[model samples]
Target: MQSPAEDSTTHAPTRDCDVLVIGGGPAGSTASTFLARRGWRVAMLEKDAHPRFHIGESLLPMNLPILERMGALDKVAAIGVRKSGADFPADGGGYNVFRFERALDARCDHAFQVRRSDFDRVLFEHAAGEGVDARQQLRVVSVEPLACGGSLVSAIGPDGPCSWRARYVVDASGRDAFLGGKRRIKRRNTRHQSAALFSHFEGVERREGVDAGNVSIYRHAHGWIWMIPLPDGVTSVGAVCYPDYMKTRRGDSEGFLMRTLRTVPEVAQRMAAATRCADVHATGNYAYECTEMAGKGWVLVGDAYCFVDPMFSSGVFLGMHGAEQAAGMVDAALREPAREAALQQALRRHIDAGTDEFKWFIYRFTSPAMRHLFANPRNVLQVEDAVVAMLAGDVFDNPRVRRRLRVFRALYAVTSLAMLPRALRNGLRRRRQSRVDFSGETLQAEES
Candidate 1:
């Protein structure tokens, strides 16, 4: 059996495992758990302890099946607030509500929004229960690929520095992008430069009945905001805006967030009587993609590989889904070394497929034509169902869904043509806005 050296005074002994996974977020936990179930000796190093706070609290219908496969669906369901649909409210006083039940796929009609701390802990603990050598409070500092095959990973935990030798490595470090950063492959997405300021609140108003748990998206002059309802009556509220807007911030994060929140009448009205229940948080330059996703001894998954806008709450779903895909590829690579190239290609295809499916909508989220389409969704050509299916994260593995998406894209194109002037104007404005760099500036303005 592979084990660490016992002599603490000497150089730290190198341990061994079939695979070493970095980060314990959804991607790390999912991949490690699945690999362990496959009988691989896996060790997962997580920088944070379980039940820790995390930002992505929303889940898509597609995530449910993966949870079921991991045998954690019941636990997730118990902690999650049932989310049946989503609501998008435009500044013009019009709105559109898309229900999951209306999606092209009939099996996945509902999802949930839970406290990420609770959700992640459930998955992490499940990984441990499945016999993964899961270690918390351990941060992977460096990973070096061995010439003979595999990698040597160095980490610092509560105890001190430690090292491990593994046949393969999986980087699921979320935004940390440990391996990607080391390889200098993480590239900022120039097309979608954005930032977010958010927090949780109690007493946020909810719609009656089935729509109570529906996540609400509100568009304002600055950008868009999301208000997601959680099971304990605590709602997650956040705004995704241009980097310039975030760079104009002033005061504390909470005050700046509140000032910005008050600008959106729809969101403001809902939060009028709400009480802040958590510290406000801000994140800038929220979109990026790694140029290389996989190589000989390592692979990047989830936010470690790419992070798009969170408009559709695709973060958790994409992370977990990528994990699912990586798990299979890792298994294949272990069994057949010669198939590494094929496995890498498959992984890339899976990642690209999901990102490409959502990126168009994300990039055009602020455009007038896209807004019009969303505000007035129609069933013509089964486009609405297709859009709903996309929101449900059903873009992959369904030929029918892909065909419907093509129709929806065609319709969007026609709509853009009909409003060419406005579309052109919005497109130009977005291009200019995307060029803004908020990285080096300290925002001082009280409001945007």
Candidate 2:
């Protein structure tokens, strides 16, 4: 088959826009919408159509402000299940619940649990309504940065081969990492390696009142499971586990997932009356980061630049926030070309700061000490409040919040030392589990 660049040569340039955005997920839509609102001509290409099924349905409280700013708050709220807190159930009959309202930032006291398909479509449509030339079923196959400036983006749309000479390119290409893959900057996150298996179900039990939409996390012997209640009464359930544990599956994905669900008491009890509503899905190597995020006339956003674990439901928040930051940087670059380097550096620093704050907790999530801390939260030095702030994605502009997190980290170190034996054993086991023998087993995805 002819390459995207080769095919582009055969067809005339279909269109031109000031900014060309690849991927129409949270990141792409947010960037496109923001640029379009600023009176910049923007064109977005999405490989898949909207309303498509996707995992990572939970949303952080911090995402509310972004949505409100985009004029999508009411649209999203109409379809969302109000989520005020998070529930963590331990294997030893201990449970801890963290309410967003208790966080340092009171503005972001609550969020919503949504179906990604519906949530993403709301944002994608908002971008189009803002005058973005949003095209669905169009995949950006290759990007060639021009010698002088800008880029030549080649894509395959429903009409056939197409191309565009864009002044700037914003890559929000989810896990495809189009720009990162092309530049060979994509690197697996060795610190945390794991996979997920998930499916939706009807009849999963949920709490009453405001807690009905709270996401429930259950810790099992092997890993953890999340149960999120959607507006339509469907519950999204998934398990994140090590490759070694996943390799023991002897049957199809559906059977394996069902058997695994039974291993977690809370998840099994809640799912006992539930009926499967979707096909089983699996994705491996959950953590990755791109070495570079921005250059000359191009910038990477969302999962295109990096993806950490979804344990704290930070995926959507980070993606949308990154898009907002990248849009500002791109706007600045378009107006003041001389400051491009500084603007790019600022964007990189912004992304790194957000990811780094979450990385610490995610890296130690499965450790004995971290688990103990989360399972038995304390308010000494307002550490629990700081953690709640972090979970709410409030670490970006709050100096007071960051300081509290530092104190919490110091406390964690001291606690870990107190439980040295258990911490060491857990650390060793985690190290072994993090090393996956990819040559021996591939990622599994089976139908029910």
lDDT of each: 0.87, 0.87
Model 1 misplaced regions, further than 4 Å: 6-10, 90-94, 423-448
Query: Taking the tens digit of each residue's C-alpha lDDT, what string does model 2 give over 1-448?
Result: 1122333465644566789999999999999999999989899999999889999899999999999888889999999999999988654684678999999766788999999999999999999999998989999888887777788888887788788778999999999999999999999999888889999999998887878889888765567888899977899999888766776666678887787788766677878799999999999988999999998899999999999989999999999999999999999999999999999999899789978999998887777788888878889888889899998999788888899999998988998899999877865765564333223454443332
TM-score of each: 0.93, 0.93
lDDT of 1 by residue, 332-405 (tens): 99999899989999889978987888998998887787888888888987889989999999988888888988
How big is the positional error of residue 368 in model 1, measured in Å on the Cα after superposition? 0.5
RMSD of each: 3.7, 4.7
Best by TM-score, which number?
A: 1
Off by over 4 Å in 2: 1-8, 90-94, 425-448
